[model samples]
Target chain A: MTNGKSDLKRLSRGDTENSGGAIWHENFRQAINILRSHKMRSGLLIVGVAIGVTTVLAIVTVMSGLDKRVQQDILSVNKPYLIVSRFDPFAGTKDKRDLMRRKKLTSSDAEAIEDRCPTVDRVDLQVNAEGMMSVLRYGNERTNLIQVMGASHNFGYMFSFSIEKGRFFTKFEQDHKARVIVLGYGPAKDLFPHRGPIGKMIKIGTHRYKVVGTMGSRENIMGSISDNYAIIPYTIYEKDRSSKRDDYQIAITIRDGFTLEKGIEETTALLRKRRGVKPGEENNFYITTSETFKEMLGNITKYIGLVLVVISSIGLMVGGIGVMNIMLISVTERTREVGIRMAVGAKKKDILQQFLIEAVVLTGIGGIMGIILGMFAARGVAMLIHFPYSVPIIWIIIAFVFSSSIGLIFGLYPANKAAGMDPIVALRAE
Target chain B: MLITVKGLKKIYDVGSQRIEAVAGVDLEIGKNEYVSIMGPSGSGKSTLMNILGCLDTPTEGKYYLNGSEVSNLDDDRLAYIRNREIGFVFQTFNLLPRANSLQNVELPLVYAGVSAGKRKRIAMEVLDLVGLVDRAMHRPSELSGGQRQRVAIARALVNNPSIILADEPTGNLDSKTGEELMAVFNKIHESGNTIIMVTHEENVARHSMRILRLRDGKIESDKIIN
Candidate 1:
């Protein structure tokens, strides 16, 4: 196209010296006319590109939103905390079976970490089961959606849980196996709307426990049912619901001036010693910091997002090829017109630019429509999943440029074929 | 001299056959001359016209247009000379079907890099010159055969080219409409622009000041028409 411009400048002088505005304007206008004349073909082409762009934009937005939500809910509050568990949080079925074969972590392991690791400040042991929905009843208010967690006395401090109206259970209460509980904010609000939840008796599975505390709302956490849960001391849980072989997950917080890495390292060593893990074998447990957990979450989401992008790009490629195919047909159909253009003074570059611009415009329109549709789709999914809505400016730019580049790359062959036509033969075409 | 041709030959290789379309023709045409080349089908007049119009280059000779050798010029440079020096009217009245008459007329000037304002003014004036001012916005598909040819002629004249070349310009029109188009060409010629036309009909050749008759790829006669 640049060669054509310079040639025009050199030749368009003397007695015929008047034709000089950026010639692209005329070519662009002509291209638009051609596309408009073939409405159905152009419409299908636009829709193809739009679907490709929409897929990319929607997936990037939703996945990035989920990533941010995970950071806020898990990593943000637990940056200085580490978890020691019987199974990996990110385990596949094979890894799960391997970890299941190993002995479960117990309260002894938790106490051993605290006693031996210099960086450890305190440890909390929590025993919980899934797929077991327990209901809590207080007078006329009942919540069948309750989650039951049995933990040691320091669970609240380690996990950033604060008491709103009362005190947390003490070591004396835990040791005595007292029938006491702390209600999360959701259950507290639902059961005791106008009055304090402390000192109230709640029923759970033919047992009654006095509410020792009501928890403050957990700010910025997402997708956790903790708000509807109640906590009971591990001593009382061991006496009532848990058996001797029941496993416990431990949360450990580092002391001031210590990093979670140092805390995890020292604690892992201590557990290896306590559990008599052999020198040549893997540890019989999993230990992970919030940072590691966040990375695992990010990697999974990124992998899924990358696969989706690859799939969507194929759609874009098909759309781009479709544009090229239609443009080739157009060139063949208008062979006589091209000959006339050549006879009248259009340079080879002019013809090339004309067709290239047509393809780009076709896909550019699709990209714009796709962006709009993508935003709406992402927003819809975000709303459905309770994920926050965010504008992904970088992804939008990438989608636009990628779609336009697709047009350029694919449009080259047909445009070149048109430009290289023999004018004499073209004029003779019917 | 507006055009000078020396030892012009055009050979076509169709499969194994080497066919000489125009063999060893020599011709000279001075400025403001109204000349016609007459020949029967396959007698090489069309090949000669293609060479003179800059649509095709000669295989074995030199063509000089306005003192510059053009037979060996490349495609782009040939396109430039075609834009600036020669105006072409086809037998089919080859105006772009999608463009209106005014746009068709503006084409040559557009290739010459004429600005929009001047291109429009000149295109309008050329349309007026061809007596089709009222049909400026009518596309070729919308115009009668006479009007379409007039539009093609107007296009040929738009850049005020050195010579107007019409190839059987009246071939597609009825005799009456053809007469009307010849009158339009007579007006264009009287305006002092050199004109070269290719035709086989004697009546069409009679409209020119001089005639060259081609027989079997060679000039049979060059005559002054009184």
Candidate 2:
């Protein structure tokens, strides 16, 4: 009776020692144990995945952010369906560079299209003229070699420019060729350090023009184009300049519900007729739309993104291969252990899942670390360059999923080999 | 009968040449039977034990356990049989070295799809039966050889399988520890579970009720030792 009571006590205690949760938890525990056993190997494997995911994430965030900014800037400059001067008529021909240098559109041609093309919503003409070699003097400070631009009265509305101070020049001032000018934010601060520029006179070359308005701060597109220029009426530019050739560029916004393609077709026919070009002769002007601009920008960005993704994938591939090789080594090192498991009724699939899960967990942890590092790195770079920092959630999710899948795919061969091992032979393996 | 084998044979192929590991053998083991098979290296004792444990299928023969044909079963069905009816122990004290004694014992029940609470209770019961309840959380590496073997014994008993197959279970232990492990096996057998073991030592074979000695892939002697 004493022995029976002791046996029951023993049985109760033994039961407590032998059981846990579900099968997945058991497998997960075993998997974590195996990975922890080889600390250096597992650490190195995770580092590889981290580097791969970091590279991919950083490049993706920067590229997508740049893309969004460029699209926004383009839309601000012109509507999606608007057409602009393409600079060169025969740019696609063999002597494209030479043809580009020869083709120029004058303001008269822009006016002709506006009058003849029914699909055109509005026409804006922009022309640049040389400012006299003069210094912008306000009180005691001065700046040299500043660029100045001349535009029609509709320039502010057409290009979405917002006035930060005062107001734009009226149609009366523009028609009378008034010597009133609007200063960009940079020049405004440089010229007037203490007081407002409204009603003040600034000398441009030989003429004095009143500062009627000032533009807010604007960012340059793609890091090369400059937005630090002063604006005046086109009549003032023509009256002051000596050149007979008008290098005026035209921007034509298409009417609502009108396709850019149709607008381009009709505008092209009208321009050709107005330019007096015969049917056999090639058209002297070129037409470009915002969509074409976006396509060209996208192509360049796509190439950059492809290169970055490829470089990152190479890192991941190396990391995945490293994981596979190390896991194979683990199987060989633990051959007897696997044999014991098989003998004790662990199925082949069980062994397979165990190893595969370990690999995935290693890579998954690495991916998480890499994403955190990459996001901070990208934000640091954006801050240094004064660009808005954009956190790309989609790229973060993608990096994690991609790295884990790499682990599963690459770990398959090693796991299958382990599962296929013969228990007797494995037990005997040294 | 808990286990039945008829004309069991196993052949291995190496580079287009076939070598017979186990020739022909017939055996029957009833409930609560304690048996030992003794043989030198390569004498087919291990092969026969593997077939009995459902770890290997005979090249040509039929094996029935609890009245079901296991020799012709597919891998999934065979795995099911192994999980539900057979427990195994090995000379190396084949517990997962990183796992604690309790976790090692609970493995088979996990495969059996038992719930956590029930599996834990059963595993703890077996550990107590083997007198290792105090060391349940100790990993195999942390335990002595005898303790490791006892853990293996606890693991073998956890599933309440019909048969416990042990191969040289005390090969890595000293004689005194080996005797202690044998005592635990005796207790397990007294509980009405069949135990089949392969051993090379005469004293180890004498501990069982029946002994079979093999040479050159054939059983040279069979006797009722007790």
Candidate 3:
């Protein structure tokens, strides 16, 4: 009876107006209150959705970071340069064996390409120890990161290698077959932590070489294997190994204003004429550009990404099913409330929308938590593996939408059941 | 007539057996009539009340509210009828436990699509009419039994329903609270709103101007107590 007169006076003004907005607001408040009241149950359901979203986002972030790293690695070799190898670097075993049986490319092929090819500006030939692992020794510090490669004096210039300390091997050293090596950044840091690497003696597989220069890192390769190689003059490697059938790789740089296609064509014609290849036969060697290797790496990464998507989709499915089961239980527990709503005249669609919105809101919250968790986890993993850190915005959007849709699809059945209940029977239930 | 039912029957199919909850019941209620239906347990009074309230459909017969045949309407139309024409008051004062009395009273207005400001005004006015304006902000759990019943009555009246149908309105209260509720109902009836209540107690039926005693799903006696 308190404030009775004022209440009646206030109610006299206009009593009829559309209450749809107010009703919707009230329903949402009620749903959130229900979730709050049952904190453990709601938290469990949210964790289910969070786990699914986290799995997908984390895997995608890691894979995307790896893809970017590999692409950068391929691009670091500089442009307008072609790699002519005896075997396709990205090919299967059969093509490699066929190229291996034909004949190992010698230093003569590099010299012929440099002299006769019209578009060629300069060439640097490399000979690597095939399938041989070298253990490097410097006093007491030992490392298995000894990738011993022999190259010409022009190797640093053709590959855009910048010296972090000291200087690259001179042309006189290449002609003299001197045992002078240039350490990559990783080997330089590891082998000479206390002092400068210049004038230091390092052993490569029982052979000794003085460190003349150290090259800084160009790009982060996915694995840390990019900076592990130690380079020496091709004359030194050939004279020491005493091998005639050395499989040599030729790196040709096209002259200014010349296309890579023209360079490849002129090199191909000169090599075929010099080696006496018959007409209508395929070239014995393989030609690869930076773009080709980049595309090939992308394809391989795509397969791995596809497999990861399949695995995460299963996790999402499991999470979606858990959401459905919990929704059903919620409907059963609130049967009396549904009856009360119907008695006051709520239509089937109202009930359906109420539950559907609740489900979406629940999963939406889960999606946000998952994104935060996944990004942090991916950053941690990238740090552990030395891969580049990349933020995948598109994947984040996709994961958010995917998680909410899972709620929409899975929450439909239980919402329908709640809407289809008979008001009389529901009211009669305890 | 505000309500008319002819040869109304409600049959429940329990497995292979059929149970006739309301068997050929005929009744007529005029505007502003204060009527009480008296019956023992299992007398089908509850089923009859459910059918009249539009919460359940009759298996066979005709029911008219304000001269419109509503015997076999669709669920949506029936929901509209329940929201606009009929107001139900359950024995337990079936209020949403989460909502306060004002919000509870505004429920039917919400379904009628009234604006929030108007709903609050009308609900407050109805609460004032029931002399429970102070209790408007109290949830059912916070209010006493008589106060909760007043809130329920306010909810029933807020929408200006054609008929306020109450089943055992005073069944769950102490005798003094029940009589106080009866006094409130007398005042409502005096204000000229039709009301039909079902109760087993004779004293409860004495408050109404007319009484119908039902047994075995049929009317055994009818009388005017003026």
| Complex DockQ per candidate | 0.33, 0.37, 0.45
lDDT of 2 by residue, A374-426 (tens): 88877777666655568677778999999898889988998888888887787
- Clash tally for model 1: 6
Candidate 3 local lDDT, residue B99: 84
In terms of lDDT, the best-performing candidate is 3
Let me know the DockQ for model 3: 0.45
- Model 2 segments more than 4 A misplaced: A1-21, A37-40, A72-75, A78-81, A84-91, A94-123, A128-148, A161-167, A183-217, A221-225, A242-245, A252-288, B12-19, B72-76
What TM-score fits each model? Answer: 0.79, 0.84, 0.86
Superposed Cα deviation of residue B207, candidate 3 (Å)? 3.0
| Winning model by DockQ | 3
For model 1, the superposed segments whose C-alpha errors exceed 4 Å read A1-21, A69-148, A152-178, A182-208, A211-230, A234-287, B131-134
Instruction: Pick the TM-score winner.
Output: 3
The deviation in Å at residue A95 for candidate 3 is 5.2
Model 1 lDDT tens row, B197-217:
998778888889999999888
Error of 2 at B103 (Å): 0.7
- Docking quality of model 2: it rates as acceptable
Please say which candidate is ahead in TM-score: 1 or 3: 3
- In terms of TM-score, which candidate is stronger, 1 or 2? 2
